[model samples]
Target: MSRQRPRVLARAPGQPQALPASLHPVLRRVYAARGLAPEQLALDAARLQAPTALKQIDTASALLADAIVAQTPIVISGDYDADGATGVAVAVCGLRALGAGAVHYVVPDRFRMGYGLSPALAELAARSGAQLLITVDAGISSLEGVAHAQRLGLKVIVTDHHLPGSVLPSAEAIVNPNQPGCGFASKHLAGVGVMFYLLLATRAQLRAQNWFATRSEPNLAELLDLVAIGTVADVVRLDHNNRILVAQGLARIRAGRARPGVQALLQVAGRSAERLSATDLGFVLGPRINAAGRLEDIRSGIDCLLAADLQSALPMAQELERYNRERRAIETDMRETAELMIEDSDAAGICLFDESWHEGVVGLVASRIKERLHRPTFAFARAQEAGVLKGSGRSIAGLHLRDALAAIDAQAPGLILRYGGHAMAAGLSLAEARYEQFAQSFAALCAQWLDEDALQLQVHTDGELRGEEFSLDTARALEQGGPWGQGFPEPLFEGRFEVQSLRVLKELHVKYRLRSADGQSIEAMHFNGIEQLRERGSLHATYRLAINRWQGSESLELQLLDVLD
Candidate 1:
C-alpha cells in the first residue's frame, strides 16, 4: 500500500569493527550498516540489564511476595491488546508457579468497560474478593482508576510501558522505564516483558527470604516463549536487551518447548513451531491472539494461552481462527471504504468516520489508510454512547500523533475528551458533532508541523547483493542473525533485476521471476500491489531475503517491499 519508490541508498556502516571471519560477509556488512557493534551481535541473556535497576521494581516485587506469604487474593488486570493478554497470562502462570495463592485475572472488554484498570473493573475485582490489584501493560495514566482501587481497599501495583502524563498515578508501586526518574536502560520492554521482570524480582525476593526452602524455585525463564510472542506482537522497538529476550524465547519455541496454546495457534496458522522465526510470531500467531481481543472477549485468547495441552487449547485456537477470519473480512471492507475517502481528500493528514464502521476495527483501518497514503490518519466509528465517536490514529515517521493531539487539545480545550498513545499510534474520543472541526484542526496542525520532504514516502535499502549472498543458506543465516523488528530492522536489499516473467495472483498480488545480472533466478512476490508495477525493462526493486515453504520443502525468495521502473 505504500507509495514509496526505492531510494536505494547504501547504508553507512557505523563505527567500524572486524566481524568474525566465519560470519557471512553480507551479514557482517548488513549488521555493521545497521549500527550493530561486534559485541552486540551475541544475544546472551546475561547481557540484559538487571530488573532491579528499574525504578520501584524491587518494591513491587516485595509487595507481591508479601501478598503470596499472606495468601491474599490477587487479581491481574490487563489491557485488551496482545501485550496485555500475554502479560496477564505470564503473570498468572508465573506467580502461581512461584506459589502465589488465589491468583486470578480480569481483562476489560474493549467495547464495554473500555481500556485499563477502570473503576468498573476494580469493582468487579472487588466482587471477586481480590485483596491486591496488579495492572499489566496499563494503569500508568490511570489516575482516577488507581484512586478508585485505593478507595475500594485494594493495594495496587502498576506495570506499564506507554508514555506517562505530567502527573503520575497514586499507586503503592509503579514500575515503568519510561516514567520520569527511572533508569531502566531499555525503555522498549513490552507489557509482558515488564511482567516477566517482576516475576524474576519476586522469585529473587522469595529466595532471599528462604521461601523456597521446602519447595523448588520456579524457573522464570520458561515463560520466555510467551514473552517473545507478546513482545513481537506489541510492535515495540527491539533493542539489544529486547533482542536477548526475543532470542531466548524464540530458542525455546524452536526447540519444541513452546506452550500448548502457542503450538495450537501456530497449528491453526499452518506455521511450524520447530522452525519458528520472529516474523512468524508477529504475522501468524500474534494476529490470531489479537483477533479475539478485536472481535470478541480477550478472555478467550488468555484461556488459550492458559490451557494445559494442545488438545485442550485446540477449541479456543479454532475459535480464535474463526474470529480472525471474521476480523479479516471486516478489515477488508473497512479498508476499501477508507481508501475511497483517502483518494478524495487533499488534507496533509486524514481523518475519516462512518457510522456503520465497527468500533473494534477502526485501529486496523487507520493503519491501512496510513500505509496507503503515508499520512497521519485517523479512522472513527460510532461509540456506544450517543453523540460520541471513538477514533484510532496511526502516524508516519516524521509526525508524532500523540504529541500533535496533545498540542491541539492544549490550543483548543475540550476538542479531545480522552486520548493517549505512543508516537506512531494514538486514540481519542470526541463529540460526533465536532468531527469536521477536529479534522480541520488536526490537518492544519500536521501541515504546520510537517515539511514537504517529511511527507514524501522514502524506502531505505542496503544496496545490491552478490549472487552468492542470495542463497537459501544466506537467507537462513540472515534470519538467524538476530530477532529483528520495529527499530532493529530486518535487512532490505535493493538492486536492478530483469523481469524474466510476471503474472498476477488473486487479482491483487504480483508474482514474478527476477534474474540478477549474474543470472541468478529467484521467485518474488508483491502482495496487494499489482496495480503499482508497469511492465518495463530492468527495474530497481527493494526486497527482504526470505524463505518460502511448500510441500514440505523450503526455497529462497524475495519479499518485495517496493519497485521503481
Candidate 2:
C-alpha cells in the first residue's frame, strides 16, 4: 500500500438497503456525503434559485447604467484562467448589448503578468483609453493597482470572488460575496458567477431607468451557459445558487439554444452542446480553457467565448485544442521527471528542482505528484524572466499548504520572497539559492500538522451501481443536478466487477470489459493502467459513472477512478 487507506464513514450501523423517493438506493449514501438533498436537486424549474436574494445587486445595476449613459471607456481586468476568460467574455457581451460604450478587456499574461491587478496591469489599462475599469474574476486585493488607476483618473468597479485582504481596494464599487459585511447568502460563487450577478444588476438598473422600455432586455440569462462552464472549470463549489445557474445553462444547451461560443468549445472538446453535462465542463472544457492560460495567453480562451459565429469559433477552438495537447505532453514529461527526483531524494518532504520544466504546466505537475506520492509536492521551473524561480505546490488535506509556506517566511524573516494561495493549492517565488531552506521549513511545518491519519488516501464512494441504473436517463438527471467541482463533487460509484477480458491497446493503456455480478456487462478503458492492472490481477473498482456514446449509440461506461486488487 502506498499509504494505508482510511475507513470512510459508513452508513449507520445497520441501515436500510433501500432508500425512499428520489435517490436510488445506491446513490443515497453518496448524495448524503456530497451535501445534497433530494428536494434540492429536483429537475423542475421551480427548484432553481433566484439571484435577487443577493444584496447590493441594485448598486451594481446603477454603476452599469451610469457607465452606459456616460459613454465611459470601460476596461475589464481578468485573471489568466478559463473562468477569468469566461467572466471577461460575459462582461463584454452583456455590456455591449446593454449599450455600454467602447468596452475593452485585458487578461494577465501568465508569463509576463503574475496574477490579479498589479501596477503593471494598471499601466497597460491606462494606455487603453479606459476611464472606468471593471474587474472580472480578479481585483479584490489590488490595493496598489486600484490606487494607481485612481491616480491616473480611472474610476474602478470591481466584481470578483477571491477572498479579500484585510483592506479592500478603494474602488468606486466592489461586488464580492467574500468581502467583509456583504450579506450575500451564497458564498460559493465563482469569478464568472460574480460577473453574472453584475449582469443581473445591470438589467435591473436599465429597467428602473426605462433603458429597456423600447429596447429589449438583451436576454442576459442566455449567457449563463458561459457562466456555468467557467464556474465549474474554476472549481467553484456547486451550491444551490450555482446549481441553478448550471442547471439552467445545461437546459438551454439540451434545448439547442446555447451560445455559439459554447457550442464551438463543445465541438473542440469532442462533446456536443446538445448533450452537455456537468462532467463535460469539469473534465473536458475546463482543461482546454485552462491549457490556454497555462501555455499561452488566456485571451484565446476569452476569444473563443466571445466569438459571434460558429465558423469563427472553429479555428480558435482548434488552436486551444493544440495548446491543450502540448500542455498534456509537457505535464507527462515533467511528472515522470519529478517522480524520479522524489524517489532519489531521502528528504522528508518533496521539492523537485528542475530548471528546464515548463513554468506554465508546473502547477499541474505538482498536483499529480502530490496525489500519487501522498505527500506535498512542489514543482519548480525556470522563469523566462531573469532572476526569478517560479514554484507551484499542491498539498494533501489537513496540511494548510499556504500557511506552511507563510510560516517558512515568518521563521527566517524574509526567507520566502513572495507567495499567495489557499489551503489546497499555492504558488510562490524565491531566489534559486534559498530553495533548500524553504523546503526544510515547509517540511518542518508539515511534520507538525500531519499524523498517520493524514497520510492515508481515502476515496469516499457511493457504492455498487448497475448498468441499467447508469442509463442515459439517469445520467441526464445527474447531469442537470451539477456544476460540480472543488467543494461539490460529481458523483462517484463503486462496483464489484469481474474482468471478462483485457486488451493491451498500447503497453500503457488497457481496453477492458467487465461484468457486474448482476450480469451487467460494460466496455471500459482504463487509461495508462496496464501495468497496475497486470500486477493487481482482475479487479474490484470504484469509478465515476457516465453514458459514453460512439457513433450515435449510447450506453453506460465507467470513467476509471480507484481500483483495488
Candidate 3:
C-alpha cells in the first residue's frame, strides 16, 4: 500500500502560570502544550482518585469481603490478554493476601472459547466449584454469560473497563468507571487498574470490620507493579490517575521490589530493573505476556506473574519469550499479506481476511494496517466454527470503533454476533458469507463520520529544541517527565537538519549523523525509513530526544518519527 506523508504540526503552547518555576524550561513547554497543571506533575500514589467514586464499588467490595469471610470458593474469569492476565494475577494475589481461600481463575482459550466471558467460559468457571465469579478485563457486554453464571448458582461481579452495551448485565455487582452513573474522575483506568481499585476498596471494607485484627493487613501497594504492566499493556489513556498508577509501579520495579515474575521477565529481556520505565512495560514485558495468549495459552503467562520466586518464574518467562518470537514471525507474514491485499484498495475503512491468518495475530495486523493507511482497519481469521470469522479492529482518531460496530449491527440485525471494546480498538465475530456486506457498511460509515482532514494523518510536535537544549540532561529530563502514553503523549520536537552522513541498517532502518543549525552533530535513527530518505541531504525531521546507552556509555539520540521535504 502507498504510504501518505503525515502533516507535521506544532502544538499550541499552554499558559504556564500555574506551573512550578523550578521546572525545566523545555519540560515545562512540553507540559504546557499538554495543558498539564502543576498538581498533575505529582504522580505519587496519594494523588490517585478514590475508588469510592467508581459506581457500585462499595457493593462490589462488600460482596468480595463477604465471600472472604464466608470462605467461599472464588473463581476469577479473566480474558486472554496482557491486561487480563495481569489483572488475574493482581486479583488472585491480593485476595490471597487479604485472607481469601480457594482462589482459582479460568482464562478462555482464544481459539476454542473466543474472547470475553462466553457461556462456555461461564460453564467452565462454574465447574471450579466456586460460588462467586468475578470477571477481569471483560464481561461488560457478556449479557448471556452473566445470566448463565447466575443461573448456575454463582454470584458474578463484573469488573471491566470497556464501554457497556445498551442493556447492562444483571451481575451481582458491576464496577466499571465507564458504566452509566459512574462519577469517577478518570474513566481511562485499564482493566487491571479497575481490579486494583476493587482490591483497595475490599481491603478498606475488611479494615472497617476489624477483619485484620487476627491477621496481618496486606499492603495493596505491592500490586502496583502488576497494575502498571497491565495499564500500559492495555494502551489505555494515561490520565493523571493512570500516570500515578504507572509512576508508582515503575518506582516499585526500579527499587527491586517488583514481583518475581516481573523481574524474571525483565531479566529475560535484558532490561535493568534500576532503569525500568513505563515504555519497557509496554514494549518489553507486555508483549511477552501477550504472546502467550496470542499464540498459545495465557495461563502460563499468569502462572509466571503468580510465581512466588524468580527460580520458578524464569523458565516460564523464557517460554513466553519463545512464544513472542513465534508470534512476531506469524504477525510479520500476516502483515505482509495484508499490505499486499490493500495495495490497490481505496476503502475508507479497510477489512482484510485470510483463512490462513492466526486469530490472535489479527489485531496486530489491523493495527499495522491502520498506521500504514491512516484509516480504520479490521483483520479477520477463520474461527474454529465453520463459516465464522473472528476479527479485530483498530481505529483512527475521531472514530469510535465499538460505536461504529453498534451502528452496523443496528442497521443490520444479527450481522455482528458479538462486539465490545473502547473507542480505539475492539473485537467481534461474524459469518464469512457476510464479510463483503460488513466491509462495505463499515467503509460507508467511515466515509460519513470522518472528514478529509480527519482522514489525513497529522504528526503533532512540540516545535523545536534550542541548540543548548540538545543534551543528555535534556533527554533524561524528558524521559523522567512522563509515564506518557495514549492521551498524554511524550514530547516530540521538529527541526531541519543537515545530513552529515547516513547509513542503512538491515536494509530498512536509516541511521544518520545530522548537524543542527548551531553546527552541533547529533546521532539519529529512523526505523523503516530507508525508502523515505531517498538520499536526501537535508530534511525536516520530527523526533524525540532519547538517551541511548551503548557499551558502558550514554549519549543523546534522536528517534525520528517523520522526515519531510
- Which residue pairs in candidate 2 collide? none
Q: What is the lDDT of candidate 3?
A: 0.93
**lDDT per residue as tens, model 1, 241-298:** 9999999999998999888998889888887787788877888888899999998899
Best by lDDT: 3
What is model 2's C-alpha RMSD? 3.0
Q: Each model's TM-score? A: 0.97, 0.91, 0.98
lDDT-sorted candidate list, best first: 3, 1, 2
lDDT of 2 at 326: 96
Candidate 3 lDDT for residue 533? 85
Candidate 1 total steric clashes: 0
Pairs clashing in candidate 1?
A: none
Q: Itemize residue pairs with steric clashes in candidate 3.
A: none
CA lDDT for candidate 2:
0.77
* Per-residue error (Å), model 3, residue 384: 0.4
